[model samples]
Target: MRQSLRSPQQHCPARRQPLPVRNRVHRAWPVAGVAALAVITAGAFTTLAGLLVGPLHREFGWSRSTIGLASSVNMVLYGLTAPFAAALMDRFGMRRVVGTALALVAFGALWTTVMTAPWQFVLAWGVLVGAGCGSMALAFAATVTQRWFVRRRGLVTGVLTAAGVFGQFAFLPLLSRVVERFAWRTAALTLVVAVTVVLPLVLLLLRDHPADVGVRAYGAGEFTARPASAPGAARRTVRALLRSARTGPFWLLAATFAICGASTNGVMWTHFTPAAHDHGMPATVASSLLAMIGVFNVVGAVASGRLTDRFDPRRLLAAYFALRGLTLLALPLLMTATAGPPMVTFVVLFGLLDVATVPPTLALCRELYGGDSAIVFGWVGAAHQLGAGIAAFAGGAARDAFGSYDPLWVGVGALCGAGALLALTVVRPSRT
Candidate 1:
């Protein structure tokens, strides 16, 4: 009996198995799809702020500056919240953090519909939505790609970044019409419904790590255990910032990204519709043009991602920034009361350039910082928002003071030129 038992034990199978077949679709893709959807939803809220400017000003007799102040607050908090959100993902898990963010966004949208005062608007739109969207910002994309993918990281990052901008600009035409035909409250309510629908999907489908699903990250050669959740999310975030701050690349990335924010999110996203309206285009037409930009942004960002995988990301950054600057400089000449050929040309080119910088920037962060890339990129993103907040307010103030957005465009264009030069100066970290 003992001899028979020994024989059976010796014949038992080994515990480990070969890595799963590559032919099968990885779970990462589906997770990425959900992440993209979440980002798109968050982006819709970000761009929705621009649309509210006109309606609020008209309805409440608030000045453009006052509306812009709320936008500035939103943009600032949106950026400031990213690093913490990233760290929170590490501590709490992506599913929980993201779901909470969606909830906050939904609540903020609902609150906006009922607010009567400027402070109330700022509290609802600025603080809550900003924090919510910030948590879902590009850093969220970076975290997902890094954690769930070991291949095609750049491509995935580009797609997610594009999703955000696509969400922002794509819905503008419909939302603008809603505001024009019905009321701004109707538009806010619409956002609440959209966000609420996405929340449950996220809670159900989104997983914290690849290991959670009995798989490794897509393209990983072998399975590895998920890292232990670090204690103190806030402490980790601060420590990451402190360590990264010592590096020259961090500052350069932050500065360039700030300009990126100022030019794109600040001046363009926030003020373009109002500026176009000022020049003679109807709100719906202006929004349609913006929507076209959103469509092409997907193309540009994805193409840039593919390129980043193959080329030197630094060079790509230089080219993208320089071209963006030139395009912004030409905007005043191209923008007219009507959607002329010149304006359309500007829209096509600008849309293509809009968020293309993100993939390369994220790649640079990964290349330079390795494991700390997500947190570092979060800080860089905060700078982007800082620039955006300043530009959003400045653009509004400039409009109120000077009666035109032309000067603001010219100023931001010049800054983009500086950003191009700054991109070239980022030094690659030495691999020991």
Candidate 2:
């Protein structure tokens, strides 16, 4: 009777011992830092296409449309390779895939320095660099957030997306100055050096899963085991595309993202500097304006990420698209020979809206698809690149034929309005 009356705690005193303390700073944050660095480095190459168009035209007498064709190839490959790369990441791990991508970029940039023909440009810049950049695209960010974070996922996604855009735009002024002061070959070589420096850092720091470092994903209550590496990465990629293609949301997302790519990468990035030149603006000044958009983009993307965590993502996308459409429609009036206050305002507003679409779009992918969101996003990203490629070529051709980019601007603006409407139609799946 005395023993029975004793408390259960007396029988198992070990159970009352304090649990092991977790680290004050999670390893996920450091890993995310490294990933962002890699993304930024990869993104540094994107604007090179725009910056080189004038220099190449002056030296080689290649038509603007020809250089635009190469850029179109680059954009298309950059988009198409994303889904496959995401699958490859799942199978091989992030470090290896990203490192390999960096190597390809370095090689491609080096190759561009020596190429003499249009096909060589197509092969080096269009194929190799495009594929390399694609491997390190927005899909990589989605994968990092999916695997390493359970909390602040939206914020991290936004930061990483912004990192890529930052790399693309921020380096423009520097590269433009380099091209003006040195040769285009020197600018390409500079890119090669940047990529080579980043490759080792990625291999040394990037881990495939949180489990590799003996920590649970950030905010997870218990340690989660790493999943076994699945084989047939190509098959997995195809299967994902096939399954997602059957769904209504996938098509809507693809269509809107395509418009996103068209409006941003295809028209603006590929043509903005040349168009500014067409208006008598100095190349360096135009590049600086583009860089300004890059700087503010970081602020916009991170803020959008924070908002994504709190607000309805669909509404956020709808608003972003609408605002962006209005801005693009007004861009023609702002293009002058110099950067005025009105031009600066346009740059700031456009920069803020530049990649803001990414975070909410990723959010919707995860919310709708659950475990397969990253893969689904890859397919969606492909659509984005396709739209961008078409727009890039079309913008160049329009300028060559009609002697102005005004019509292209107005066309893309209308398409963005369509994207806004599409964003509203994406409803969450109903529960049983």
| TM-scores vs. true structure, each candidate | 0.94, 0.94
In candidate 2, where is summed lDDT lowest over 10 consecutive residues?
15-24
RMSD of each: 3.9, 4.3
Clashing pairs in 1: none
lDDT, model 2, position 206: 93
lDDT of 1 by residue, 192-223 (tens): 88887889889988988999988999999999
Candidate 1 local lDDT, residue 65: 94
Clash totals in order: 0, 0
lDDT per residue (tens digit) for residues 1-432 in model 2 = 777767666897676654433456788998899999899988899989998998889989999999998899999999988888888999999999999999998999999988899999999999999999999999999999999999999999999999999999888999999999998899999998897787778888899999998889998989999999979999988888888888899999999999999999999899999988889999999999999999999999999999999998888888889999999999899999999999999999999988999998999999888888998998899999999999999999999999999999999999999999999999877768
**Candidate 1 — worst ten consecutive residues by lDDT sum?**
14-23
